[model samples]
Target: MMDIIDLKKKAAEIRIRLFQMIHNAKAGHTGGSLSNTDILTVLYYHTMRHNPQEPKWVERDRFIASKGHSVESLWCILADLGYFPKSELETFSQFGTRLIGHPNNKVPGIEMNTGALGHGLPISVGMALAGKRDHKDYRVFCLMGDGEQAEGSIWEAAMSASHYKLDNLVGIIDRNSLQISGNTENVMGLDPLDKKWEAFGWHVVSIDGNDIVSLMETFNSIPYTEGKPTLIIANTVKGKGVSFAENAIGWHHRVPSDEELALAIKELTEQIESLVSKEGQPHE
Candidate 1:
């Protein structure tokens, strides 16, 4: 059984580590990384079944981060889970570090090398299809950004997933709305996003991406429908934790200064403390 409260605390800590990773490295997609933190947290800490000690376990679930630039959070989660030594994080974005700015397959726990915007979903579809053909029980999950929706290849992959009735594939979109250039709608409108997925034959579920409780419940109801791929539209705020960066466009690829890092650290620390105070308490 997964402890919901611990999951919440883990997410907060991951956010702090994620910020530290970028601050030390002096480069990262800050806004997107923070926006998708909760989703990544829930998936790694609660939903997915895998052995960090045996990352290549044959029956383990596969995860692909399609929106690869915001990989700082994922790296933090993997290290915290013991996929690699925590010390490796200090080498992030340095000369010849496996912990680059995007998801890299060379790093253990990552199923594929992504970040090209539209490639993750298609590759995941193929993985799910292979699992079905092999009679394996593993599921494939892909995390993508809202801005990546502009890629036509995503839809084609969606169509293919549904055509194959890939119920084993689940995808979550961090609908933070802001891209590097600006708001997603302004850069490329993707409103009516749910309808578009439904039309493509996916089982769609919309949820508050930041809420651990809600995300856990949603994942429990996966394969929303039989014979369909599930698509979760996780509405999120860009730069989720730090006040100055939340929903701020400039934070997309901006490194935080020392002062900003102090502020972020303080915010994330408080979040963890707050959760600790509520530990073992009943929620109404």
Candidate 2:
């Protein structure tokens, strides 16, 4: 297991890199990306069994970015992990770049092209079922946004995943409370979200999505019940790492200004330095 301090350091690095990408691209779903950075850091660095060198390795665990709009964080992680040249991140959202506003299969690590919302879970269910039918041990992880829960297709897919007893499937919701329009509850009430998934037959576990320790622990304990899929309701704050953006509805997809970018970078850098100092490691 990776040390908690190390994981926290990596997540802060990722946040800084992602914000730089967003700042350069001048477009991104800022809040959601920040909110989910820790969740993704744990999965890619600690929980998931994947190889950047052999992206299509049959035995590799699969990840589907269901809430695909907030893909900058994933992009930065993949680049850092050698999925692609780190220099390529500079092309994000540029014309003719594979790193578009949403997940694109053209990228090595992305399992599917998503951003339509409501499609990731359904596709993940199919993948999990396929893994079962083939007798493969590979697990399928699908990350979705809280706002996306309102889509009827999500419920249908939830029902199917449970009915099929796809224990290999793990569904994660970035429950940041805010969405593009406004607060999720104001747009479409989805309180008692965990209970709803439980009713659909998933084994629900709620945790602080921003806490890397919690994320590592939760993901390490997959298929909470043998015959059921696991649903992690990751309660997170939108724009998590940036002081000005944290929990702010306006930051959902808002690009950071030059000053905001500098400030965010400074804040995240301090966090990285703090962690490194405690660990007695020289800051790179």
Candidate 3:
């Protein structure tokens, strides 16, 4: 039951840790990971019911990183939660490491092998459907990239989730507006995305994805409408929080230089400090 302030501080810490991981790896998706950090922070720390010690807890809420390229933030969060040794983060992206560039089910916290884009949501629909069949109350959360919306399979899965009345299924789009090639609109044209999801029978909500408070508020009120899947269009800035990289298209998969990494860390550290200063004070 963390307050908004603690959640905000945790998100900053996650951003700092994830940056360190990507910088150490020297080969990782930087922008999307940064963009989705707050969303992950809120789900892991405040909203979702999960167990680091018991990764297979049947009653725990399930999460699928449908937009799996930006796994750096997820890896940091998993390690920080003790799903594995935090020291293993140094081995990320190395040859022969479980911590590769994508989500591998071999990892304790991961539920599926993803990163092919368009596959995660389909798989999540199955998981959600299974939960319903078993009469389980756990929720399934699928985090998708706005750029991934161009995949036809995503629409198929969206229709399936809603058709089954899987109100337990929650889909969050990290609408950062940028992908590997460039702007998503220029690439695949997914504008009016919220309306599109609603058309498929999902209850839709749009919010600033990077805002910790907004993310917390949105996630806390899941399944916004009864008997419908929930879709949150989390509008966000790619490469969020890093001053030089914010909204920069080149950072989609670009590794930061040593100087850039240092500067990013400095900025994130200052953010942590600022949040800490307001810790004991009253929150609005």
Candidate 4:
């Protein structure tokens, strides 16, 4: 298990990588990607079981970035994990690059291609069902956007997963509050989200999505209920860790300018340095 400071340092590096990748692509989802960095960091570096060298290991855990626009963060983590060469990240969104704006299963570590809202949970349900039927211990993790809950299909998949008693499945909602057009609450309210999931028979946990400790604890506690899937409502800021982008809806799909990119990188570097310093000290 990585200490909190080490985990935070990894997250900062991921953020820096995310900024550089998107900036180089000149077109990518920055807001959503930044929002979910800490969660992805925890999953990849600490909580989840995965093999970078053999991505197809049947018993290895599966993670689907259901909100595919947030692929920037996932891409960087995949690169850091050695699933693909970091050099390939520079081709994100290029005309013929496999690293298009959304996730493509053709990409080495991606389990499924997803971009359209409400698609991931259903696919995850299928994966989880297969694992259960085959008696595989591998867990299926799906990350969805808060706005996606407005989709009826999400509820349908949730119902199906509950009925099947898929204890090995875990759904994480990146509750960042903003979507492409506007605030999720204004578009379609999903308040009392935890209650809603509980009513659907899921074991629900809520946490500060940007906190490494909270993220690790929530993710590690999966399958908490005896016969139910788990839902983690991760509250997050849309443009986390970037000064001008945080909580700013305009950055959702906007690529940062060179100046903005420099600033964001500097911030991330400072964060990484701080974490490194903390890591060097003895724990209290």
Candidate 2, after superposition: displacement of residue 22 in Å?
A: 1.1
**What lDDT score is found at residue 192 in candidate 3?**
88
Can you write out model 2's per-residue Cα lDDT over 115-178, one digit (the tens) per residue? Answer: 9999999999999999999999999999999999999999999999999999999999999999
Q: Rank the candidates by lDDT, best first.
A: 2, 1, 3, 4
TM-scores for the candidates: 0.98, 0.97, 0.98, 0.97
Candidate number achieving the greatest lDDT relative to the actual structure: 2
How would you encode candidate 4's per-residue C-alpha lDDT over 1-284 as one tens digit per residue? 67788888888888898888888888889999999999999998898888889999988999989899889999999998899998998888898999998889898889988999899999999999999999899999999999989989999999999999999999999999999889988998888999999999999999899988788777767779988999999999999999899999999989888999899989989988777777758853
Worst 10 contiguous positions by lDDT, candidate 2: 275-284
Candidate 2 residue 227 Cα shift, in angstroms, is: 0.9
Worst 10 residues of 3 by lDDT: 1-10
- Note the residue pairs that clash in candidate 2: none
lDDT per residue (tens digit) for residues 157-256 in model 1:
9999999999999999999999888888999999899999999999999999998899999998887899999999999999998899998899999999
RMSD of 1: 0.9
Q: What is the C-alpha RMSD of each candidate to the true structure, in Å?
A: 0.9, 2.2, 0.8, 1.1
As for TM-score, the candidate ahead, 3 or 4, is: 3
Error of 4 at 166 (Å): 0.7
Q: Local error of candidate 2 at 216, Å?
A: 0.9
TM value for model 3: 0.98
Residues 197-269 of candidate 3: C-alpha lDDT, one tens digit per residue: 9999999999999988889889888878988999999999999999999999999998888899899989988
